[model samples]
Target: MSDKKLALVTGASRGIGFAIAERLIADGYRVVGTATSEAGAESLQTKLREHGDEHSALVLNISDSEQTEAALKALLSEYGTPFVVVNNAGITRDNLFLRLNEDDWNAVVNTNLTGVFRVCKALAKAMLKQKAGSIVNISSIIGTTGNGGQANYAAAKAGLEGFSRSLAQEIASRNITVNCVAPGFIQTDMTDVLPETQKEAILASIPGKRFGHVDDIAGAVAFLASEDARYITGQTIHVNGGMNMG
Candidate 1:
C-alpha cells in the first residue's frame, strides 16, 4: 500500500498484541495480525475495520509447525515480508511447581519459546536479504524475576530473551535488531480473569499503585520497532509499573 514499514503481530486479536497492531497502523504501517481461530481472525478484522484502518488478520496457530509454516508462506506470498515481527502468542498454566504436570509445562514452553523460534527462523532469511528488520518479542517480568506459580511460563519467557539476545548478535551485521518487551500486570482480558483477591494482591506490589494499560506496552513496543530505536539491540524494555526492576 503505502510502502511504509510492515509489522506482523502474532496473537493480535486482543490484549497487548491488539494494542501494538493499532499503534502501528495509526503510524501508517500495513500491519497483519494473527490469531488462533477463524472466529478470532474474523473478530480481529472487524475490530480493525471499525478503526477504519487498513490492517489485516490471519488465522495462525504458532505452536503447530505445519500451521505456522503454511501461514508464513501465505503471508509472504500475499502481504510481503514484514519489516517488523512481534512474537506475542503465549499461554500460561499456573500452579505450584510441584503440582505442575508435564503437559502444562510442555504447552507453555512450546507456545512461548518454540513458537517465537519458529517465526524468527522462518523469517530470518527474508530479513537478512532485505538488509534490515526489527524483531520485538513479548516477554514478561516473570521471565527476569521468576514467580512462584509460573515456573513454566517464566522459563519459556526467559528463554525467549536469551534467544533474542543470541539472535540479535547474529543479525546485527545485517542491520536487523532483536529485542524484547517484558510487561507486568498489564490490564488485559487475562488479568481480568483473575480473582479479585489475586488482582488486589498484585496491585499491592506495584509501586506505581496501578496496573499498566495495554497501550503502555503498545507504545513502548512501537517505539522500539521504529527508526528511533535503530541503534538499540539485544535489550528488554520493561513496562511493569515498578512491579519488578532489574
Candidate 2:
C-alpha cells in the first residue's frame, strides 16, 4: 500500500532481528517484524512506529506448526506477498552432549531448524508465484566450528545452512534467491554478562579484536536482500570478523 516493497523479519523484538527490521525500513521497505509474544510485538510495533506507519509487528511462534501456518496465512492475506523474507528467529538450548536431554535437543532443533522450514514453506509458494524475492537465514559460526556445550544448537544451524543451499537451488529458476548470514560472537545482552576474562579470551581469537555489532549482521542481511546480491545465492556470508576463517 505504501508503494514500497514488503519485507518480513522474524525475532525482531530485539538484537540482530530488530536491527535488520530497522535497516530494512530505512532502505524503504515496508517491513513486518515478528515476535513470539504480544508484549514483544507491541513493543516492536511502538519502536518501529517511530520510523513510519508503513512498518508493523506481528506475534508469530514459528516453533508451532499450526500457529506458524495461521500467522503466515494472515500475513499473506494482509500484506500481500513479501519481497524479502528473513528467517532470523532461532532459540538455543545449550548443554554438553552427555548431559543434554531429548527435550532440550528437540526444543533447539524444533525452534531453530524445523521452525525455519515452516516459515520458508509457508512463504515459498507465494514467492515463486511472484518470481522475485530474497531469503536470508541467520546462522552462527558455532554451526561450523562446533562449540563444546552446544551440540543441539550447532546441529540446527548446520542443518539450516544446508537447507538454504538446497532451497536456493530449487528457487533460483524462479528468480528468487536464498542465502545465509552467519555471525560470530555478536555483542548482545547474552554476551554482555560474560566475565572480563572470558570476554578477553573471545576477543583474542578475533582478528578484528571485537565482538560484532547488530548492525554488522544487519548490513549483511540488507545486502543479501538487495538487488546487489541478486547473483549471490546458496552461499553463506560470514560476518564473524574473521573469527572462523578456514
Candidate 3:
C-alpha cells in the first residue's frame, strides 16, 4: 500500500529464510513468503501480522513444478507481480559420494536448483511485464568451496550461481537483476543440529572467531535486494566472516 516494493521469499517458515522475509518486510517491501506445509504457511501469516497483510504467505512445495507454478499464480493473482523475489528454498542430504543414492541427489537438485528455476520461469514474465525486478538466490559457502559430505547440495547451489549469472544477462536489458548471497555458518536449526565438536571446528575455521548470525546474512541479502544494488548483477556476495576470500 505504501510506496514500497513487493517481494516473495521462498522457504520462509524459519531459519535464514525467515530472517530474510522479516528484514524485507521491515525494510518496507510488501512480502509474500512460501512454505512447504500448511502449518508453516499459517505460522508465516502469524509472524507477518506485524508487517500487515500487504505481505502474506503461501504453502507449496517449491520442488514440485506443478505446485510451484500454482503457488506463483496464486500470489500473482492476489498481490500482483512482485518487484523483488528471493529464491531460498533448498534442502540438504549430506553423505559421502560412495554412499549417496540417486534419490538423495535428485531431491537436493530438484529442490535447490530446479525449484529456483521454476519460480523464476514463473515470475520472470511478470517481471518483464513490469519491465524491472531484482532477484536474490540464497546459496551456501559449501557451494563454492565444497564440503566432504555435501556433493549433491554443493552441486545444486553451485548450479544456482551459474543459473543466476545466465539469467541476469538475459534480463538486464529489461532492468531485472539477479544475484546470490552465500552464507557461511549461521545460527539456525539446521546448524544447531551439528554436533558440538563439529560446531567448534566450524567456529575455529572462521576468522571472526565465531559463527555468523542470521542478521548478518539477512543484511547482506537486503543490500543486494535494495535499490542501492541496482547496478550490480550476476554477483555472489559472501557473508562468511572472512572464511573464504573467494
Per-residue alpha-carbon lDDT of model 2 for 74-147, expressed as tens digits? 99999989999999999988888899999999999999999999999999899999999999999999889999
TM-score, model 2 to reference: 0.99
Local distance difference test, per candidate? 0.91, 0.95, 0.90
Q: What digit string (tens of lDDT, one per residue) describes model 3 on residues 104-181?
A: 999999999999999999998899999988999999999999999899999999999999999999999999999999
Candidate 2 Cα outliers beyond 4 Å, as residue runs:
none
Q: In candidate 1, what residue range of length 10 has the lowest lDDT sum?
A: 47-56
TM-score versus the correct structure, for each prediction: 0.96, 0.99, 0.97
Residue-wise lDDT of candidate 1 within 1-246, one digit each (tens)? Answer: 657777899999988999999998887788888999999999998888775556789999988988898899888888888899999999989999999999999999999999999999888888899998899999999999999999999999999999999999999999999999999988887788999999989999999989999999999889988899999999999999998877
Q: List the residue pairs that clash in candidate 3.
A: none
Clashes of each: 0, 0, 0
**Whole-model alpha-carbon lDDT for candidate 3:** 0.90
Q: Which residue pairs clash within candidate 1?
A: none
Q: Which is better, 1 or 3, measured by lDDT?
A: 1
Candidate numbers, best lDDT first, in rank order: 2, 1, 3
